[model samples]
Target chain A: MAYTIELFMVSVGVGLISGALINISIGYKFHNKGGLIGGLIVGLLMAIL
Target chain B: MIEVFGLNLLGLIGLILFFGVLIASLRGWIPQDILPVQSALMLTAFILIILAFILGKPIGLKDIQMNIYLHPITALIAGFLVAGALEAAGAFKAAINILEKLSKTTLGLPGTVVILVNIPTIFAMPCGRILAAALIPAAILFGYILAREHKQPALASIVVFGFIVNAAASCGPSPLGGIGMVGEGMAGGLGVAGVQLGSFVNAQQIAIMMITAVTMLSMSLVFKITPDELLIASEEKAEEKREKKEGVSREGYISFFFFFIGIAIVFITQPPIPIQTILIFFVVVIMLVAKISVKDLIGGVILHPIMAMISGFIIAGALVAIGSFDVMIQILNVLAQTPLGYIGVAVLIANIPTILPMPCGRIIAMALMPGILLFGLRMTEIGLPEIATPILLTAFIVNAAASCGPSPLGGIGGIGEGNLGTAIGSSGRPQQVGIMIGTGIAAVIISFFGFI
Candidate 1:
């Protein structure tokens, strides 16, 4: 049971790191001018819902 | 599953929207001009109504007889009419003249505008997609004007960034912002309430604050939009982006500020009220302040009392048609109870549909929430909900971090950049891309770890 749990955690962290990187790379375009506004709009949506 | 012209009700409806967007986009090619997205949106609602009635819906407000999709249909119509009329009326321009004069003074224009005016937008654009539209076009125009002058982009970008992430990262249960919704859905999937479980029992806000600071700093890295630049461009293009927004909707101001107070009370006050109620209250205030007549307001409310209610009803109908929400819920419960940590479980589940390029986190409520509730039983089994609160909050925050970006599908990243370089027409600033990208990435990384 302990071994299974550790493996699961490892899988999750790895997957998330990849996913996060992809999302951020793609999201970087929003860095300019109202990018803050744009990104935050999306961020706020995520926070609320 | 009976076929109507080659598909069932759901499939047929889906195809109509699909083809509608395609048709809308295609028109842009010939005219080299986009279809008034208004036309496309209106047609989408029209077709949904027509389909709902054709599939054996009856007429009248007798509840069961009336088509569920009609609400969205009328809501879209009413919103467009009022907004269009307001623009034609030059309601904002009337307010603009006063600011133009004040901007000519030593204080300059955009400098004054960003502090008092645009900061409020962070509070205003909560619904994300539709509500943000009102400000997105305006923001793009402002960014272009800033680029035209030798002004650094950081100052304006930071203010906009604050609103963006705040709305996304906003805590509590308020529907006045999308961040609240994201929090709710995430908490709900874990068999918890957002304001109560994720918020009340955690240190998530600390992380958010930290991340927010970093994000702000990074947002300023590009455009070299330092305090120095504002003083330099006190006139010209800077003033063009900087005109102070006159407060026309006094009622909107009162209601919005109250809306913020209500969110604050959610944490510290007694007898918690549903944030949904708070949302309704503010929206009603907005309706009145926008000068939408009482009669029109009533009509629109009758049409759509709930935000996205039409989609809700349609999904409800789809559940019945496809079999049962109960069955999906049971499957979800089974999956959620497998001792997988909530973060991993949610990310895995959300990304599964990524192959089809579907949205994250929202659609699974009917499918995965039951499993989450079942898993909550495990918490009592081992006394973990309180113990794991911090971990759970972090996971939930991570989930809220999505955007349309460099991708063509209107991702968050792309929307942010749309105003920076290519988004500004003609004399656009391609030179600013690397700086902006660097700052945005820094913000995202900080957010990934939890707070500013």
Candidate 2:
């Protein structure tokens, strides 16, 4: 498959979201909401950009 | 010549802070509890936001919300989860058992080590650590068996070294895993202005050939594992005992089938829909058939290296926003204009991860790839051969990805050290450095031959 710019951006977006959710879940599991917030902030930034 | 040190004031600040964060992350200078990926992302975001504020640029949640529309991240996550689900479903164990039996029929412990070490190349899972966690014990067991048979305890070390080389270097050929996908994603990013990223399969094939050859040869010549030792077999009764333990499970078979089905769908259809969604759909089906729990699915498959990748993306985005890549390209561009500058830069890029070892190749790739790609593009734009870009960039990608295995801090090398009861930096360093330099030199040579 051709590697298009559109595809690259989509991958970046998905990576950010999935990564945020995963970290947030881990943080919650451990009662480390600070980490959760940290993850959420990064995720939010990616979403915004 | 806009400002200080060839950077505008904002660019200078970004460059300083970016390297500062990178160095701190690499050196474990951050808070004890915070993950390196986490620190890198948050700090980068904070730096960029502050810089944007100073420059009077509006940054808001509305901008972040747009990240949800992107499709490729889902595909990347799906690839990881598919491997994760299969791993959770006991498919790897079954495969290991089958491999163990097959190894018995080959020469002996050396053959078993070969099979166990190289298994990841064929399986191509996203979770290299998890896969290593599972397989290292099996390797150790075989190593002990070899040591006992040969009456030399050092044989076990040889086996461990061999396993590290094969397993760590196997990341290149995996089309669906974090290593392969991240490399492809970086290549795709470089696909701007009519450059084709080429087939993921082709990259995988080249990675496999180069890594396997370099690693195996090093195992033999450097590690002193002779061909005769590899060809010898364990005692017949011991072989039978291993054979008797091999039994197929219906769940394992089904999980295996689904894993391949996911891969086949990816290869055959090349579906535009986020591949992760498709793979996860298959994973859900496997979970239903195999009776896997929702908790297990989320806990095991979703949380790990996937999160690491997210943090990496955020950090990468922040770097780009702050003009880090532009500065990097300017410096590298100057370097590229010199004699043999491309080779020098390729060597430096290949070794950076080893010097500042991270747990995942994706993190390093995400951080450095833009600069690397821009360097390649600039070289081509400057009248170098078109092949120069991919060959040089591929070399950088392969080395960066493969070097993570030998990282002294909690990567495959750490796992190997843990199993061998050796100190953290002592045992796996040679093999780690060997593979890093070996694969790197191999790529450079291949690229020189225009094979990349």
Estimate, for each residue in B1-452, the C-alpha lDDT of model 2 and write its tens digit: 23667765565566677667657765667642565555566667676777767776535544333322234355555665666667677776676676566555622334344445545554555556656766665666666666666675555555565556556655554544545455545656656333332233334333433343344344434544321223223332343466467555678777876775556556556666555566778878888878887666665554545665665666666666656678777777677568848667756766676566666666676666667777777778877677666665666656656666766556677776666666665544555545565455545444543332
What is the Cα-based TM-score of model 2? Answer: 0.74
For model 2, the stretches where C-alpha displacement exceeds 4 angstroms are A1-49, B31-37, B55-72, B169-173, B182-201, B208-248, B257-274, B337-340, B441-452
Per-residue lDDT of candidate 1, residues B1-452 (tens digit): 44554335444454445334534433343131344332343345445445556756422223322224342233234433333333323333333443344445542434223321222222332222322333443443443344444344454454344333322332222233222233334454455433333241112222232233344444454333222233324533443555444333454444444444554454344335544454455445555556565554343231211322333334434333332333433444455678765434544433321211112112222222223333344444456543233233333332332211111223233334444432421111211222123223322332343221
The best candidate by TM-score is 2
Cα displacement (angstroms), candidate 1, residue B32, comes to 19
TM agreement with the true structure for every prediction:
0.43, 0.74
Candidate 2 chain B: worst-modelled 10 consecutive residues by lDDT: B226-235
Best by lDDT: 2
Q: What docking grade applies to model 2? A: incorrect
